[model samples]
Target chain A: MTDTTARIPKLTRKGQATRDRILQAAVELIAERGVVGTSTEDVRKAARVSGSQIYHYFDSKQALIRAVITRQADAEPVPGRPMMGALDCFDALRAWADAAIQRQEENGCRGECSLGSLAGELGAADEDSRQDLSNGFLRWQGLLEQSLRAMRDRGDLRPDADLGELSLALLTALQGGTLLTQTMRDIRPLRAALNAALSYIHSFAADQR
Target chain B: MTDTTARIPKLTRKGQATRDRILQAAVELIAERGVVGTSTEDVRKAARVSGSQIYHYFDSKQALIRAVITRQADAEPVPGRPMMGALDCFDALRAWADAAIQRQEENGCRGECSLGSLAGELGAADEDSRQDLSNGFLRWQGLLEQSLRAMRDRGDLRPDADLGELSLALLTALQGGTLLTQTMRDIRPLRAALNAALSYIHSFAADQR
Candidate 1:
């Protein structure tokens, strides 16, 4: 976050609004039409910014895209969200799953995961985007791992369980679930995937029974 | 398969070879460049087909893309492969998981799922491509469900096991694993994802133990 803020020059309120406007426009259009399908002219017209205003703020489309990525990555975690904050507990795990699933449900299963959608589309061919997505996913997984580690430390999870692996598995399931949900236009796939993953994690919960 | 075969005209051996050549070229270029990135002229040049020849085979880039999707879908399952043929058994599941992981490994984690890759970029905006992807994923899931149902018939799995949901979960995990593997350029993500999912399925096995 600091890195992003530091990179951008100091701007007046109007300049900042213009930049925000451009990014917001990019987000909506790029999400729908994809990066290739959207052009600078479309962004400029949508944002009501002159061509020079765009160039002054963003040297190129790629720069603007990176900014959009940064914006999305930064906004992933909902502020003041208890569920995401307490994934270490089994109940919180369910809540986290609920939050994840409800996110898609709210969007009507559209663009299940914005960063994931971008990574799937462009990660295969573009090194920069791949790196961005890899970092983005790792950061997400890291949050899960941190909570799992907390669970382990608190004697809620098995000591021998591999937290890193478990976190990655959970993430994998979520991504798969969200993708299926969006494609099939059905919520069941995501629900099943998350449920299975949470069940697996609970399997390591010190065998409470 | 019958649907695809019926679309092409009855052709001589030479014509079949030409069609195969075009599809092969399209696969390579389109997988790497994506639909919007690769052009008809690029495919025409890559396939070494003249302008007239390109038009003779496909009406437009979209038609060629659909053909490519069909070709990839047809080749997804290994002919007479036990692992894919019998996803219900433990050994076969391992083999299938290995195959899925190894595919991405072989490509250095590039475009782990080509159909998925294309769908992510175009599916939300393009109805035809979305339908193609949805069908492709369903067919893949159907193969798993068929094997699971067979396993249940043989008492390999509990009758109460929701085979439909389980198959969906497995496919979801596989897709997630492959996507993470591709993005992170790592194998552990895929390994962990598939293992977790399979373990969940095994938990539903009739407890012979």
Candidate 2:
């Protein structure tokens, strides 16, 4: 949070709106065509702003992309997934998986700009973007850990269950499932992936005897 | 197979060598950068071939990328993964997972060009590329399915187990796990993902009664 806050330049309300417009345009463009495909000039035109205006908010393309990563991270786009927060129970986790699969199906399995996709594109070559993506995933993992810890406290999960590994597995299923869904143009991979992860979690369920 | 065969232009042995050089260069560049970042000129320079030579082999950048995808598919780069084949039993599956994690660890978790990464970059926007990627994953899935079927035939797994879903689940864990490993710069995610999928499969183990 401090890092993100410190990077933002002071701006009046109007300036903030202009910056948002530029950022939104960049996000859409980057989603459609990755970071390498999106140009500042393209963002400028998409935002309906002048070249100087884009420069006013972001000093360079790297800065703009970093800003996008920061925004995506802060937004908690993938794992938390907007309305699907507080995954503290097995039922909640199952619902989350269903929602993700349904959403992908609704979109015809077209891959969108999620943190995972961004990481897939940027994680290899760019060190800074990799760090940003790492942080984003860590934050998501923290949320899942909190939920698993809650389940453990509630005696829904076994006391000895490995919460960290469980959370990481769920996340891995998600990132991988979504990738396959995009590539295969089908929802079954995502469904199978999530079902396997969920069943794995269920394997660790408390005996309740 | 017929589609790929029809697309290849007839070439002399030297012409084939030149084409191979160009394709290899493009693969390296695309792996390091991405499909968008690697331009025709870059391929020309990297391959040490003239622009006319590149055009003689690949009529367009799209054609070159498609060729790469087809090559990657036929090679079965992700699931078969070069040396690891016939993942028909529990031991082979565990060994494959360990090797994957070790390989990622050796590379410092730098994401390499795999079918997954290429699909992540090109799957959404390009229909032709998306079809190519879809075929690649389907081929890998077929290999996994065959392995799982062998296990079933061997009475290692329950006859009731859904081999297709099981195979898809394993593939999802792999693709998702690899993506997370690349982003987080850690092998733990991959380890957990593979472990969970393996556990899921183990859950369906024969009663041995």
* lDDT of candidate 1 over A50-110, digit per residue (tens): 9999998888888887777777666653333554435778888888788877877887887
- Across residues A105-207, which tens digit of lDDT does each residue of candidate 2 receive? 8888777778888887777678898888889888878877888888888989999999999999998898889888887879999999999999999888896
Per-model B-chain TM-score? 0.91, 0.91
Q: lDDT score, residue A85, model 1?
A: 31
DockQ of 1: 0.75
List interface RMSDs for the candidates, in order: 1.3, 1.5
Q: Please report the TM-score between candidate 2 and the true structure.
A: 0.91
Tens digit of per-residue lDDT, candidate 2, span B5-114 = 35666867898888889888988998888787789999999999987888988889999999888877777453444233387788877877777778788888766778
Please give the lDDT score at residue A82 for candidate 2: 30
Can you tell me which runs of candidate 2 are displaced by over 4 Å? Answer: A1-6, A78-85, B1-10, B78-85
Model 2 is docked with a DockQ of 0.71
Alpha carbon lDDT of each predicted model: 0.79, 0.82
RMSD of 1: 2.2
Cα error, residue A9 of model 1, in Å, equals 3.8
Off by over 4 Å in 1: A1-3, A77-80, A83-85, B1-3, B77-80
What lDDT is reached at residue B206 by model 2? 89
TM-score quality measure for candidate 1? 0.93
